[model samples]
Target: MDLDVAQVRAFVRTAEELHFGRAAGTLAISQQALSKRIARLEALLGTPLLLRGGTGVRLTEAGRRFLGPARRTVAAADAAVAAVSGADRPLHVDTWGHLYAPMRTLARVAGRAGELVSGHGRDLPSVAKALLNGDVDAAFGRVHPPLPAGLAHRLIRLEPVDAVLSADHPLAAEPALRPDRLSGGVLWAPGPLDRLDFLHRFAVRFGVRHTATSVNLGLGHFLAEVAREPDRFSLMPADVPLPRVPGLRSVPLTDPTPLYAWSLLWRSGDEHPGLKGLVTACAEEGGRSRWLEYDPARDWLPEPPASGPEPV
Candidate 1:
């Protein structure tokens, strides 16, 4: 039997997300249209692919089995189209935090004329939204999962997270500190990271109180806050050069430090002619960098319990 590719896509996405609203948002379609497409697909198969009781949706046994073949079909279709057309569009790339050097390399690979919009998200999810909403073509950030159905990701680099404290603090003298040592102390962080469930759970497990601030403090103010408060701390990238602040100190976090596994994310099958080259640029830039390493084993963050779908 022939199947409509668009209807199949709608069913697959809705099945993955289990929420019509989110799936529709990802596909840039109305929820009603998405539901209708799924209903049509179900009619064609003469079986309910999803179990929509009351609270939300869950896949039927058929859906669980059909998902694999459905994905393969979609992938093959996209590949065929890409091979035939070989069309390319101008790409937009963006990121959060200080990922400038490697992103500059990406811009060069995208083409000197390609647009690179920086600071797209305060955190990863916002960046994912920008991609879904067509605000940007590509973005760089952490790869938290239950990601949308049609997004592609490449692990670019592992950025080491370290501790920032007052120079006069007792722990500052240590070459490296462990999470247990941070117990009972407060870690002041930018709002985004603190709001993440993984970080929150990890902090609680380690007995540290992670406090997020709404204000984006300047470097001077950041240092002042660390130095002025005895019980306060912050996190930073260990390999990145630190400013010489007399009262502030940066120390390595040893014994399983958290590494921000930076990745490049874009919608799969979109295949801008320059996207492949831009990814190559990120890989080569990651290769030459002394600070960023490609270690998948050490690049993971703690996973929190799944409540709903996570993006990026």
Candidate 2:
């Protein structure tokens, strides 16, 4: 039987992710397209390769047996293309958390990293999938627990977060606000609290009682919404340039500052020529700007910093 390499690739990526939505994203296709590819592959094999249920997709016995050969097939196809097209293709990089201004960090290293094609992922999960699927060479974002296997990350920056409040708010005038001091007010988040790891953990850790979510139209709109209510406030990286929203002030959180961690993520075995230079640039920049400096006694992180040197 003649196997379609694309269909085999679709199955492999879906099996790896176990989530159709993320698998489709990594392939840069719609969910419907991904499903069709998998269905066709199963039909070609004359048996169901995967079982879909409430929990997630699961591999059938046939699928378990086919996975190894399928991976080799995909790798062979990629190698053939690379050999013919040359290896000088621009490295594709992606980022997540636009609201936090991930580009601000990437911009500093882009020029030094050589030719690059940049894109954006909805979040770290999507970006991680893209890395594993070989769609992108590198990514930058907050790397937390429960990440998929076969991925690596390095802590690049530890940006201090600030509380954005309306100028009319009582605490807005304070030179610096302690985390617990804002516990009485509502925490305005750009999206659902659960999806926003940093904000959610900050609320629970610092005793923020009331929380509200809003669509993240853009930084300006989000900040404007936060400024509309005297009792509402939200967290943002201190270095992000605040749009000129009226009656909005950013107050630094003190007595244990909340440091938003930024990390570089890529597939474990990737040897993309540009990857090393990018990591080196991040390390140099981090050292020059003290981006990785953290003191547990004076700062807060949702988890302990990643261990080991920056992956080169």
Candidate 3:
């Protein structure tokens, strides 16, 4: 029986994510389409591959047995396509956490990294799924654990964070403010606190009790909102260029500054030539700019950086 590559691919992605919505997102297809593909693949094999329960999807014995070979098949198909299309295709890189302006860091290395095609992911999970699906060659973002298997990351930068508030706010005139100084004020965030791992961790750690959120329309809009409320404040990477939002003041956070970690994520065992160039360039730029310097006594990270040796 001739196996459809698309169906096999659907199964592989679904098996990796175990969530149809995310898997469908990685495939850039609708959930219905993903379901149809999985169903057809199961029918062709004449066996159930996945068990769907109230909790979530899980691999049946057949699926567990087929997963390894299915992954190989998908890789082979991708290899075949790359072979004919010329391997010099521009490396596609996805970025998330736009509030931090991750591209600013990427730009420092872009000149040395060669041809690149940039895309934006909604968040780290979506970017991770895209990396797993081979939809993008690499991604940049603030990666938090537990990172999914089959991926690798290298810490590229640790940016000091600043507390942004209205110039009219009482604390705005301070050159540097301790994190606790903002405890009584509302911590403004871009979305639901639970969904924003970094900000949520910061709030919980710093004793910021009251919290508020706004749609992440962009840096300008978000900062403008913060500028409007004297008692509202938000965190931003110190290096992000501030927009001309009136009444905006960015004060450095001192006495254990919160550092925003940035990392480069790619599929483990990827042999793309451009991937090597990008990694090397990041290392060079990071070293030159002192991007990875950290002092536990004076700096704070939500979690330790994932800068361990590359996984095999």
Error of 1 at 237 (Å): 1.2
The candidate that achieves the highest TM-score relative to the unseen native structure: 3
Candidate 2 residues 186-229, lDDT tens each?
99998998788889999999999999999989999999999999
Query: How many clashes show up per model?
Result: 0, 0, 0
Superposed Cα deviation of residue 193, candidate 1 (Å): 7.3
Task: List runs of model 2 lying over 4 Å from the truth.
Answer: 1-8, 16-49, 52-57, 61-84
Model 1 lDDT on a 0 to 1 scale: 0.67
Per-candidate TM-scores read: 0.64, 0.83, 0.85
Taking the tens digit of each residue's C-alpha lDDT, what string does model 3 give over 57-143? 999999999987787677667757876784798889999999889999999999999899999999999899788788888999999
lDDT of each: 0.67, 0.87, 0.90
Candidate 3 regions exceeding 4 Å error are 1-7, 14-47, 52-58, 61-73, 76-84, 306-312
Better of 2 and 3 by lDDT: 3
RMSD of 1: 6.6
Worst 10 residues of 1 by lDDT: 303-312
Q: In the order shown, what is each candidate's alpha-carbon RMSD?
A: 6.6, 4.2, 3.6
